[model samples]
Target: HTSYVLGCAFSPNGRRIITADLDNKARVWGAETGECQLIIGEHTHDVKCCCFSHDSKYILTSSWDHTARIWKATDGTLMNTLRHEAGVDSCAFSSNDKLIVTACHDKIVRIWDTERGQLKHTLAGHQHSVRSSSFSADGNRVISASYDRTARIWDANTGDM
Candidate 1:
């Protein structure tokens, strides 16, 4: 974990916790005893955001290193590393946890296949840095909010804005 903790999220069952820190790491913690569980130190810069998959089986994090990463929630094992042109500001897990959406300072929103670790779609329409992105309840769509004073909806499958 970094020197300054940036963001944190709790598992769906509330048994564990994950934190993103300026130390360029995300850490898994035992919620009950506040004991440090696992340390993910792959990011080369500050970690901006971190989140858990809906089912609490995975952890996702975005960082100033211009990347987002996924890890196994139970053991902190890295599953994937997603690269972007600019710092990754935020990320979201699809309803089924099979996909991820990453919003970055490059003003692009990228969708990814979790299992295969492949790029799915690049939803590029924002005129400024995208602050955050999310998968819709049904997981058929994605929404992004940007510093350009716009919130856009997109077709997750086709990358249509």
Candidate 2:
């Protein structure tokens, strides 16, 4: 009841809820009882968004720290760190779970290889900050929305402009 919740996401199974907070923490709770099950707290800045991986085995968070992190949902272990030029606004995994896309305040979108934890490509064009991004239904492309008053489609595999 005292938690400063900022973003909330339901697990794929709907039994658990994950919340990201301005307090620089993320917590997992029971949806029915509001009982906290786990806490993730490695972020150095306020967490803006969080989500459970498709399999529910991992938690992904984007923050003002200019990075997005992936954690083991079961134990809160840090698994990966995805960096950006400016604050990270949001992130999402491809439908296949093999790639991740992050929208950043630097006005660019970046794709990462989930398994290797390496930056795959940067899609640049927006004149202002990129606010959000999502994978196409086929996972072959990404759509990015920006504060620049424009939206863009990018080749997910190549990061083409």
Candidate 3:
């Protein structure tokens, strides 16, 4: 159906596809047939990114509206809303699935507790907008790249340098 897709992610099992769009919506669909399934639409601005959780039951979306939202994959129910100081550029779930990290135009990187939707820590050092962020393979640290011409490493638990 020519979805206005901005980003797409496959479920862990590869059975479903989750997509985010500039239209401020995210949808879940059948991977093989491209059949539209669930649709999530609460974002006030363009959805820039989305990802399926490790278990494939949830979808995470980052938007220009300065927030990241978590949704139930099956029914598109809102699960959690994560806010940042500025527009969120990207988000990633930790490999262990316990934490979520978001990079924002506010020049900060933030870590959140996935289940509780609580702010775990904020990593601040970038002099310009943060472009991307990710958790280390060991899940003990986070790495962030910024337009500030630098990349930083922080303790995952404390967001310390």
Candidate 4:
């Protein structure tokens, strides 16, 4: 039912799991029973990463199609999309849930306002693809890891790399 698993995440409550695949799909599964609960197949290219919101109310999936989409966790409803200039590699919710961090193959990490879907910052410094990124506990800083063999800390609000 899929090509290859790229990334996966457990819902905040730990009851559900979401898997991103190269098949251009993301599937929600019952963690305990291993049952496929929902299938999200809207992306036109390989889905790179998938994750749950901090409150477990939503799911977000990033893709090589240059979009990171948010969906309702319970019903699989499309909520919002974060589009980038290049293939997005990963996305994650801020610790406080006010923002999302998206890393891309364009050697940049972008911070997006979750509620407004506005671009916050574009952190540019890495020489290779930004493999992943996340916010610090205070949500004021960002940490990004790259295939460039370096991990950097940036100012989340300013995009200072």
Q: Report every candidate's CA lDDT.
A: 0.91, 0.88, 0.89, 0.92
**For residues 5-79, could you state the per-residue lDDT of candidate 2 as single tens digits?**
777899889989999988889889999999999989899988888888888888889999999999998999999
Residue lDDT tens for model 4, 102-140: 999999999998888899888989999999999999999
Q: Estimate each model's TM-score.
A: 0.94, 0.94, 0.93, 0.95
List, residue by residue over 1-161, the lDDT tens digit for candidate 3. Answer: 24567778888899998888888888888999999888788999988889988877778999999999988887888999998878898898998788999999999999999999999998888999998898998889999999999999999987789
Tell me model 4's lDDT, rounded to 2 decimals. 0.92
Clashes counted in candidate 3 amount to 0
* Candidate 2 Cα outliers beyond 4 Å, as residue runs: 1-4
Candidate 1 lDDT tens digits, 56-152: 8889999989999888987878888988999999998999998999999999999999888799998988999999999999999999999999999
**Model 3, residue pairs in steric clash:** none
Best-first order by lDDT? 4, 1, 3, 2
Q: Give the clashing residue pairs of candidate 1, or none.
A: 2-23
lDDT, residue 18, model 1: 89
